[model samples]
Target: MRATVNQGPVDIDCRPTLPNITVMLYKDGQQIIPDFDKILPIQKKGFLLNDVSFEDSGIYYCQANNYTRTIILTVQDDSTYLSEPEIQIPSNTHFVLGSPFSLLCMLNISKNMSQSNTKLEWVLPPSAEV
Candidate 1:
């Protein structure tokens, strides 16, 4: 997931509604407390990150019961790119156990920027399967 600086009141939802389920959100491995201004709890279902900034860019984990879903949010500065790149990701990052999943990263660089100089990379978690 990618967002421009100051781009939202973005909502990050946790899925597969279960009865009496409680969702907890974590940022960069640290549990996030709802500060209302920055992180807002969404009825124990997920979180809403308000007024996103560059510092908000990080890996978010939505944990419920023993299941966990991971989201990598990249907050880009609009001034750095001629146009913001389009990113597509699954709404639900959680996968069934032993199931295969794929991730895609694509960029639409501006003509003004040198294509040879532009680079796209994926920084995967150490435990991630290739």
Candidate 2:
């Protein structure tokens, strides 16, 4: 089976006897598969995939013993035209006076999602007058 992770060395988490396999990771036409130090499949059954991220998005597949399974990952940008973040502004929030401030920009591909996919943006206060 195919697997993926955030931008980093390619990692695998499968069985030791799963027959040392090689997988590929990609992003915007670039490949980021690590040469060594990949996570081996847990020696036990029922493995869980933790910590999913944007750069970790892509397609994965494995062909072993003449059999195959595929995994697909879709990484949505924070500013998708197909959904919210459609308007670039905060919703009824407070701002401090005479202090530097910022907005947390979250481009929601869906209305039901939040935080995990957002990035922070900083805004500086106007300079003090003489």
Candidate 3:
């Protein structure tokens, strides 16, 4: 499922909705329940995110007792109304020790995305090894 950042929340629930079964949630590959800030109680069964972000977009796993279900979440940027920005780095690279090289960040934006609200910013690492 796809959701827009700062627009609407996303919800997921177990199909069977067992009474005594304990529901657990996982984002990407890590457990995020209890510690997640956006989690909210669902209709007596499952949970929902109050506000989603690009980082929240990933494979969501729900473990209820022995039953497990997965949901793929694709969060869109509110500004551009597009999916998360993708940074592509070529495999082969040529860089001089002290020379400056330009890095390009790429993202797949469709016609539905807003061009005027899109802004790109580059962040540098705190320290460089070389």
Candidate 4:
């Protein structure tokens, strides 16, 4: 997984949920305590990393019972990009209750960044449906 500095509150999910399971998260072999402001537990099934920075990049371990999974997170500096990407929403957009609407996002990738390295993502409100 790749994230940019200050770009999250990112969630790392533990799959194959089981009954009454407890998940433990670790960074570089050190267990992450929920009380920490940067990384926290999420419903005993995953973790959330907030205010991500380059130091947060490393091997992550998610353990449950006897199963363990490894995740590699790479955090990049904002300077990796020449400039912030631009987003343009249609003018005068409106929607009625219970109606469906679509949004278009346009991004301009810097010449130094490859297509695979540049991604456009939409984060919806918590109440919004996929």
lDDT (CA) per prediction: 0.75, 0.44, 0.70, 0.74
Worst-scoring 10-residue span by lDDT in model 4 = 1-10
State, as a TM-score between 0 and 1, how close model 1 is to the true structure.
0.55
**Every model: Cα RMSD to truth:** 14.9, 14.3, 10.6, 12.1
**What TM-score would you give candidate 3 relative to the actual structure?**
0.53
lDDT of 3 at 12: 74
Q: How well is each residue in 1-130 modelled by candidate 2, as lDDT tens digits?
A: 4443333334333223354544333334554443333322333321233444564566654334444445565545444324444334477767667766665555445465555665545445689431
Order by lDDT, highest first: 1, 4, 3, 2
Q: What is the model-wide C-alpha lDDT for candidate 3?
A: 0.70
Which is the better candidate, 2 or 3, if ranked by TM-score? 3
- Which 10-residue span in candidate 1 carries the lowest summed lDDT? 77-86
Looking at model 2, report the run of 10 residues with the lowest lDDT sum: 39-48
TM-score of 2: 0.30
Off by over 4 Å in 2: 1-40, 44-50, 76-130
lDDT of 1 by residue, 58-104 (tens): 88888888898888888865545744556677796887778886766
Reference-based TM-score, model 4:
0.54
User: What is the Å distance of residue 46 in model 1 from its true position?
Assistant: 1.7
Cα lDDT tens digits for candidate 4, 7-117: 677777765477588788888999887776777666744788888877888888888889988888887765455455566668998878888877665666656668887
Residue 85, candidate 2: C-alpha displacement in angstroms: 9.7
Candidate whose lDDT is highest: 1
Specify the highest-TM-score model's number: 1
Clashing pairs in 2: 2-61, 5-56, 10-34, 12-39, 13-40, 13-41, 14-40, 14-41, 78-107
Residue 126 miss distance in model 3 (angstroms): 48
